[model samples]
Target: MSLLHRIEHPRDALAWEGDMPTLGRYTAGIAGEKFFRAIQEHGQFLGTVCPICEIVYVPPRLYCEQCFEHLDEWIEISPIGWVHTFTLVHLDLDGNPLPEPLPLAFIQLDGADGGLVHFLDEIDPEQIFVGMPVEAVFKDPAERKGSILDIAYFRPV
Candidate 1:
């Protein structure tokens, strides 16, 4: 039997002399790209409103989930929103303790039926309450690249 070796770090694994098959490369499709671009370039929030149900989807959808209608109406939505719900996470993505607790929230933008799950900033975790009003803080126009991170985080209003 051969000894089993473990990869402690990605950088260390680079020393291996074998083919490393990789399989993960996720991407946000066309609708998401369009939404991100609007925010990244113009500092605007975009949503798609369904004509049939009048429901709006943020991160605008190509088609309505409810009525299955093709969504063609793209409307701008306010970045100001309320936190529908949230959680205080104390660990990092690697399950290690973070220096501080982070608030992850589901923010429901005004005038939109659906909400977005994103990080919250500039507030104490203890002070975080459901229905708390928040607003998006975007990166400088020159720094934006049409990514969700373009809006750094939502801060208490």
Candidate 2:
């Protein structure tokens, strides 16, 4: 089967409801706190790199999973990378199709060994490709909050 075929859209009102008691509130970790602060204060992108293993983790980290050691160093990551995978989201979980479609892609960030999943904007679905280059788009400095939304989306570079 194709990768697109494996993708499923939520088709019921229950899926869109946010009233579930099990839903958790947003809490910041030590590393994540630093990350958000940087976005809000400096408009910079920082990631954690294991000094021992050299694995770069975006959104930063308190420890290296591979070497099993505490990490304190931060590395700046490039906003550009290739799209490893992507999909066109046609519906908003309520089963209703959106007035306009959006594309979300898993971008393998440059300089990091891995990637992050985020929305891709300002491009048509037919224009997206598996290895297309993309750059992060940051919100206006004044409008930025300490959240991932500070980086509005990735756009073709």
Residue pairs with backbone overlap in model 1: none
RMSD (Å) of each candidate, 1 decimal: 5.3, 8.8
- List, residue by residue over 12-127, the lDDT tens digit for candidate 2: 22365566568679777999999889888887778988878989888688889888889888887877888999999999989898987889999998988787899999888899
Q: For model 1, how many clashes?
A: 0
How would you encode candidate 1's per-residue C-alpha lDDT over 30-79 as one tens digit per residue?
67888988998899999999989989899799999889988889999999
Off by over 4 Å in 1: 1-20
Write down the lDDT that model 2 would get: 0.86
Which residue window of length 10 is worst by lDDT in model 2? 6-15
Output the lDDT of residue 146, model 2: 93
Q: Model-by-model lDDT, in order?
A: 0.90, 0.86
> Over the full model, what C-alpha lDDT does candidate 1 score relative to the true structure?
0.90
